[model samples]
Target: MNLPHDDKTCGWYAALPPPQPARRLSGSQRADYAVIGAGFAGLAAARRLAEHEPDARIVLVDAQRVGEGASGRNSGFVIDLPHKFALENPDAQFKQRLLRLNRTAIAQLQSLVDEHGIACQWSHAGKYQGAVGERGLAYLAHFEKLMAALGEPFHAVEGRELAKVLGTTHYSRAVFTSGCYLMQPAALVRGLARSLPENVELLENSAIQRVERDGLGGYVLHGADGQIHTPRLLLGTSIFTREFGYLHNRLLPVMTFASWTAPLNAAQCKRYSGTFDWGLTPADHAGTTVRMTQDRRIIIRNTYKHVPKYGRSVDDSTRESIRAEHRKAFLARFPDLADVPFTHTWGGVYAISRNFTNFFGQLEDGVFASACDNGVGAAWGTISGTLLADRAVGATSSLLDDIHAVTGMPSLNPPEPFLGIGVRTRIRLAAWNSRAEV
Candidate 1:
C-alpha cells in the first residue's frame, strides 16, 4: 500500500516553529474506532467520534506528521460557498444547501479556534476573485450574475480601485465576497490536532502498510512498527483510499504546486499598496492563486499534474520548471519587488472526482470513508468528516441530509493510461485557455 511522504518544503509549515516530536504506534493496540489520515477530515472524524462516545478509545494515525500533508499544504481559504457551481447547474436550492453546510463547517472551526486560542493568523478579511483578460472577465461577469441571482452579497472592483486593493494592475476586474476566511493552514491543522478530545489517541509517522479482516468481524491495520485492531474503521485518506482497497477509479489525484516569497522588507512593503492580509483567486479555473500573507510575504500557486501513483515524487527538473512558473507569475503581479526571492516551493495532492462530487458513505458494512473534497477541503472536509461520524454513530440531523443531497457517489474514471492522458489533456487545455489569466 502507498503511504504519504512529505518533501518538507511547504511554505506554511516552514513558517511555523518546529513541531513536537512525533509519537509512532508500537506493539499491538486495540481501540473502539480507528481513524486513518490525520488531516482535516480525519481529525474532525476522530474528534467527533470521541464526542459521541466519550468512553470509547479512538486511535487517529497518519503516515507523516499531522500538519505536513495536504491539509497544511493548501492555500488556506475557508470558502463558504461553491467556487463555480452556479454556472454549471444553476440550481439555487442545491447552492443554498451547500452554503449552509460550508458555513456550518466554518462556524465549527471558528468555535474551536476561539475556545482553544489557536493562533493560526485566522483572518475574516474576505477574498477577491480577479480577472486579467477577456476570458477571465467573462468568468468574473458570470460569477457576479450568479451571486446576484442567489442573493449573495458581493462588491465588484476594477481599474484604480482594483489596483489599490490588490496592489497589482495585472487584473482588470475583480469581485469581493465577505464569507471567505484566510489563515495559516499548517498552524490551524496543528492546533486542531493538539485540541483533540481526551479519548482520542494520535499516532503520527505510523503509516498503515496493510489492512485485513481480523476474522471476528473487525479490521486489523498493519503499520510499520505495530498494528491496530478495531471493530470499526473510518478512512479520511483522500486519494490514498485506493491503497486501502476502496474508491478505485473514483478518485483523480492531482498535484498542485505553490511558492511563497521571502517576507518583504520595509521599503518593499511600502511599494506593495494592498491590504496587509488578503487572498485573490483567479476568476478562471486555471489562473494563478495569489495571496498577500499577514507577515508581508507573497504567494503564487498554479500548475497541475495527474499522479495515478499516490506516493510518486516530482522530479527535480519538473520542480525547477514549476518554480520558474511561480516566479514568472509573481513578477507579472509585482514587478516593483523584483528582488523578492521565493523562500519555499512545494507540491500537494488533492483528489478530484469525475462528476465533481465527493465520496462520503459506507465502503462496506464496518468501514466508512470520506475522500474527494474537490479542492475545497478546508470547510467541506471538516463538515463531511463531522457528519460522517454522526452517521456512523446512528445520529441524525438536517446537516447530514444536506451533505447527502449535495454529494452523491463520485463517477467512475476510465482505467489506467486513458485516465491519465485525459486528465493531463484537460489540464493543458484549461491552462492554454486561461493563459492570459496566469
Candidate 2:
C-alpha cells in the first residue's frame, strides 16, 4: 500500500498558530472499530461510531497531521446547492435530495462550531460566481436560469456594481447566492479533532502500510512502527484507498494548486475597494477561484494536473510552474496589488470518478468506505462519512436511503497509459477553452 506524502506547505495550515505535539502510535493496539484517514469523512465517522457505541474503543489514524491533508487544503466553500452544471441531472427530485443532504452537513458543522466556540472565521457571507469573457457570461446566464427554475434566490451584479463588489473590473458579470458559508478550513478540521468523544482515540503521523485478514473475521493494519487489530474497519481515505487494494482504476486523482499573498498594509487596504471578506468562483469550471480573506490577504487558485501516482510525481519544477500560473492569475485580477508578495504556494490532490458520482457502501463483509467527493468534499464528504458510520452499525433512516438513491458505484476507467494520455489531453483542452476566464 502507498503511504500519504503531502507537502507541508498548505496556506491554510500555515496561517494558524502552532499545534500541540502529535501522538504517534507504537507497538500494538486493539480497537473495536478502526478508521483509516483522518480527514473530514474519517473524523465524522469515528465520532459517530463513538456516539453509537459509547463503551467501545474507536481508533482514527492519519499519515500526517489532521489539518494538513486535503480537507484543510480545499478552497473552503460550504455550498448548500448542487454545482450549477450538476443541475442538468434532469431529475428535480434528485437535486432536491442532494440539497437536503448538503444543508444537513452544513447544519451539523455549524452546531459543532457553536458548541465548541471554535474560532475558524465562520461566516455566512455567501459566495459569488464571476465571469470575464463572453463564453463565461453565457455559461453564467445558463446557471442563472437553472437557479430560477429551482426557485433558488440569487442577485445579479454587473458593470460598475460588479467592480465594487469584487474590487476588480476584470469580471464582466456575476451572480451572488446567499446559501454558502466560508471559513478557515484547517482551523475547522483541527477543532473537530479536538472535540471528539472520549471513546475515540486519534493517532496522527501514523501511516498504515498494509492490510491483511487475521483469519478470525478481522483485519490487521501494519504501520511503520506498530500494528492495529480490529474486527471491523471503515475507510475514508479518498483516492488513497486504492493503496489498500480497492477501487483500482475506478478513481482519478487530480492535483490543484493555490497561493495567497501576505496581509496588505493599511495603504494597500485603503486602495482596495471590495468587501474585506469575500470568495468568488469562476463561471467556467476550468477557471480560477479568488478570495479576499478576513485578514486582508488575497488568494488565487487555478491549474490542474492528473497525478495517478498520488502527489509523489509533483516535483520542484512542477510546483514552480504552477506558482507562475498563480502569479499570472493574481496580477490579471488585481494589477493594483502587483507589489504584494505571496507568502505561500502549495498543491493538493482531489479524487473524481468518470461518472461524477461518489462511492458509498461496503466493499466487503465488515469493511465499508466512502470516497470520491468529486471536488465538493467540504459538505458532501462530511455527511457521507456520518451516514457511513450509521450504515456500519446497522442503523437506517430516510437520509441514508436518499444517499443510496442518488449515489452510484464508480464506473471503470481505462487501463494505465491510456488513462494518463486521455486525462492530460482533457485538462489541456479545458484550460485552452477557458483561457480568457483565467
Candidate 3:
C-alpha cells in the first residue's frame, strides 16, 4: 500500500536495513500466550514470558514487520523521567511506582544492549526540555520546584548555565539529567526481533481481525488467514489499538511528524560547538522536540491536531507543514543554521489513552490491552510488557496491580461534528501563537 509520504529522507528508524519478515501461521493454533503486535511491548512481553516459563508456548503476530509501527518511527530517544509527574495529578498515588518503573525499564534496556551485543549506538547523554517565554518559564519553574519537593533529583539549569550545556540562548530555563539515553531505535527493535528465542513464533504481515470469546472460558483471535486460540491474549498495538473496538473510544492515536537534515559538516557542527548530541523540547503549549542522530542529522517532531476531520493518516500537506515548522524552529534556536536543508521527513501514529497514562490489565476475560505511551513509548512500552509478562506468569508483583487499579480516563473533546472542528481550530490558534512569538 503506497501511502502518501508522511515526511521525506526515510525516518531515522528507516536508516537501518529492513528487518527480516516474520513467519506467519496459516492454520488455527493453540498457544499459552498470543501477543498481538510485535513492537517493543509485544516482543519484550514475549521475551519475558519465555524467561519465566521456558516450556510455555508463545506466539507474537504483527500486521507488518517488527518495529514497523510507532516503535520503529520514534525519534530514537529513550527517556527515563516520568513524562507526567505525580504533582501533575496529585491525587494519583500510583505515579510514584510508575516513575520508578520507567527508571528501571531504561536501566534494563541498557543492560539488554550490553548482554545481547546489539550494535545500535547507545549514549548516556540526557534529554533537555525548556521554556522560552514567561508562560513557558513559569511552567518550568513550578515544575522544577515540584520535582525538588517530590524528591525527584535532577539538574535544573537556567540562563548562562543552560546556555553552557546546549550552546544556545533560545531557552530561558531548562531541566537536565542523566535519566535518558539516545539509541538507534529501529536498530534496537530489529536487534530484539533477531534475538527472540526459538520457542516463540513471530508473524509479520499478519493482521488480526477480531478477538472473540471461545465459549469455553478462553479467547479466539482471528486473523485474515489464520486463528490462534489461547487462554490468554495481550494486545500491544500501542497507538494503533484504536482499530480495535474496545480501545477505539478511549485511546487517541496522534500523528507525530518528523524530519532529518543532511549531514552537518564540522563547521556546521561547530555552529553549536559540537554539543548537538542532546535532545530538546520547548515547554510551550504546542510542544516540539528537537533531536540529532548519530549521523549529525537533526530530527524534529510535534503531535497531530486534526483528528475526526482528517482521521489518523498523514498527507503531503501535513508532512510539509511540519518540515517548514521544524526548519523555522531550528533557525529560531540557532539562526546561523537556517539555510541548511533537511534531507528527510516522515511521520507515524502513536497511541494516547484518554487519561494521558498508558494502561495495563485485562480489557476482557483472557484479553488484555496495553497502549497509550503519551508520546513517550520506548521505555514505558518495555516496562508494560515486562509487567504484563510477570502478571501472566502469576508472579507476585504489586506494581502491576497498582497500575491497573489507578483509573479515571483523561477526557478530550470528542472528535465529532463541531467538536472535532473546534479541536483543530484550537490547535491552529496555538500554532499561530507559537509563530507570533517567532
- Where in model 1 is the C-alpha error above 4 Å? 311-313
Going through the candidates in the order shown, the clash numbers are: 0, 0, 9
lDDT of 3 by residue, 153-216 (tens): 7777887777866767877777876678988777888788788877788888888877778989
In model 3, the worst 10-residue window by lDDT is 1-10
lDDT per residue for candidate 2 within 171-200, as digits (tens), equals 999999998999989999999999999999
lDDT of 1: 0.90
TM-score of each: 0.98, 0.98, 0.89
List model 1 lDDT by residue over 326-420, tens digit each: 99999999999899999999989989898888889889978999998888889988999999899889899999888888877889989878888
After TM-score superposition, what is the CA distance of residue 284 in candidate 1 from its true location, in Å?
Answer: 0.4
TM-score of 3: 0.89
| Candidate 3 colliding pairs, count | 9
Report clash pairs, candidate 2: none
In model 3, which residue pairs have backbone atoms overlapping below 3 Å?
Answer: 7-345, 7-346, 8-344, 8-345, 9-344, 9-345, 239-351, 354-410, 355-410
In model 1, pairs of residues that clash are: none
